[model samples]
Target: MDTAVEEPQPDEFICPICLELLYKPLVLPCGHAGCFWCIHNAMQGLSFSTCPICRQKYNVCPSVCSPFYYYLKTMYPKTFAQREADIKKEEKDMREQSSPSPTMPEGFDPSSPASLFKCEGCHKFAENPGVPACGHLLCDECCVLEKCVVCSLKITYIPNVCASLRDHIHDNYAGLCSSGPLSSSGGGEVRDKFFKVEGPGVKIQMIGDTTARVEIDEENFLHFHLGCDMCGMFPLRGAVYQCLDCPEKVGYDLCSTCYELQKDVNTGKFNQTHTKDHKMVKRPFNVTKHHLILANNP
Candidate 1:
């Protein structure tokens, strides 16, 4: 009898950004997924961020997808635990090398769209910013919560005003920094102002709203016609990215955004062994090719 426990295959559950087991995976609206920190690092604050693979545009990072996060944890406990340990060491090493500097926030630049430090909760320019462990900048007013609304990470350190950052913004980028916090009723005003400034097609997900919607209205969420194989969004909605190369009759399909992000990820939710060699085609919502495949298979 073989008693050795087989290790989980690296190719099955790896994050494209980190090239390791997915940890605290956050599924994007495009149906692609990435590790929380990886997404955080990739996000272009104050502007629309693009999918690392497909370059699909998005703004506001989301919290961890609870279902997928737990599934990976259960399926590959050993590898997940090892990845956690490795990340901790890497973070510690990174912190040790970089002492606090007043040059400017790493991702912030006056010349770029990410010039301002926007609150993750309200999407308002944080005059006095609160830096959390996850590094999602928030206004002091939005920092009242104990957990980060963006990643749901526990706030280990009190969110204090980064004076150095504040001074840098004021001195270098005159008028970019707001003079003070918005009024209590300024949520709408802030949103309107952001829209006017950022222009149309720009979206900023208020982390708090996402939390409330998930808890209060998840059961009432709309279901689409087909499910995305990558994000597990049942009754997949929007543009469907269908694989043209997989031999499985059940078919391999991803959300268009996910298709672009997961080009390297060739596996499927239903056991379709898709590979990088597989070609995919994007189908609009009205297209019946996917339905035809399902109908014929059944």
Candidate 2:
């Protein structure tokens, strides 16, 4: 009998930003897939959210492609495991070899939120630093907040942040749901979210984890509770409205744009039922990037 060694899968699983196995891979609006962190970092300081490969402007946030995910999970478990181990080892080594007693920039406040996370590039609190999927973020000040002094890793800054950071910044915007006469149009578009999507075609997975795209069937989208009933728009700019009396499927949800338009009830800009009579609540639209192939279709 002959023994054969396992080989790593094709480079499809490798992230262009870090040149490593995909970590929390997500599809960009341009039909390319990259690690969540890598995509986020690349989107910073650019006039258009252009894909690194095709230079297509990103119109909205993306989701993880499921077929690609299963290809790695079910088809190449050994490859996935080995890459994960390598990433962990690399991080450990970086942590040990990095500079010690790093100094903070002048006027650096010790009480700042990022004070605890020091950047090696500027020797200061790396406020909103871009964290690479495989290596680390350093000196992203030219592109975004915080100043990492490391300045060694080559990368860029992006407006889209990691799902974890978005969670902490949630609930800052207004929702479409209201108990009585509506308030302002959810105060215009929040523009805080990373992607925009349309109705009837979106394949939503309602899983709680925001780190990576979860693999689910198209039928699973039927159970999504956060869809806007009146509009096909997704949560790229803000949260979708929900109805207290009617189920999301029965036309109770409202997008922020529609909510603010019908503030007077008789304006007819967003002609809908008496929403003020319904009790509704707002939750962060914690959507992550979908798989690349699915993203192109969606």
Candidate 3:
């Protein structure tokens, strides 16, 4: 007696449309495979003239339920049931996870007067208190005076206590803010600009012609500039210098046009000098002409 051999099953194929195990596989001319329902839904709105896979030009309609469906129903019945069960379980879990929680922060009494704290500047009681300048409390108005404590000159309003002090004092004192406004004798006004020089230090107003001031930092460095002084001109004219090696002119200059022209001239001169030097360096072996001839021949 002869025995029969069982054929290997095709259970690993997946449908591209539903992204599940293919229940009814259909192959297009381009050899791409998808489920029957996926292809039908995709072609329903569009003209039924293109292959669903390679999009090859074809006018024939897809064939109806064939041997693929029967094979799926008989061989993979358990797989289909398992996939449906997994989907239902996932949906149930999602619904449970989306439910709201019941909790609140400690000391969150909204109605209690004792829970309220006052703003140092405004003196108004709220849920929070405003702390400024080393735990010093001030009303919002005093905090936003927009004036330097040391000079009394109007400075830009920076909200933080440290930023305000830094702008007012620059980097002068170790801990204390400046004693509001330096006297004019130390650095008198010039061309509507004030200049203050103490020892090797110098402070100049880079902006605001009529009323401006300087602030020093903790390291005694003046880093802040205010106003539209100089109409945005450079601090000095002759401060700019030409480059030593290259024909490039660099450094700070007052006029933008003059600075740009100097840069262009310097760059051109540098390039010319570089080209001449390069040619001279290659003069010992006359190889440049031979290389050029070979390159041209190609």
Off by over 4 Å in 1: 95-197, 200-298
Ranking by lDDT: 1, 2, 3
Candidate 2 lands at a TM-score of: 0.32
Best prediction by lDDT: 1
TM-score to true structure, per model: 0.33, 0.32, 0.22
lDDT (10s digit) by residue, model 2, range 100-132: 111333333434423323444455433332343
User: How high is the CA lDDT of each candidate model?
Assistant: 0.51, 0.39, 0.30
Candidate 2 regions with alpha-carbon error over 4 angstroms: 45-47, 85-298
Candidate 1 has which clashing residue pairs, if any?
Answer: 226-236
All candidates: CA RMSD (Å): 19.4, 24.0, 34.2
User: Per-residue lDDT for 1-298 in model 1, tens only?
Assistant: 9998896564545676888887766544333557766876776532356667545554434444433444455556788888878876876886421111112333444345333455656777666655543445677776667666754544433434543334434444446665642232110111111111122111223467443111212222222344456544334444667888887666777655466555356355435767887787875434233333333343
Lowest lDDT 10-mer window, candidate 1? 186-195
> Model 3, range 1-298, lDDT digits (tens) per residue?
6585453343345665677866434443223445544653454221123444345432211221222333344445677566546645854874421111112212324443222123323443311111221122223345445542312323222222222112222222323322433232111011111122221112334466566343322222211111011111112111222223433232211122233332222212002222212211100111223223323343
Better of 2 and 3 by lDDT: 2
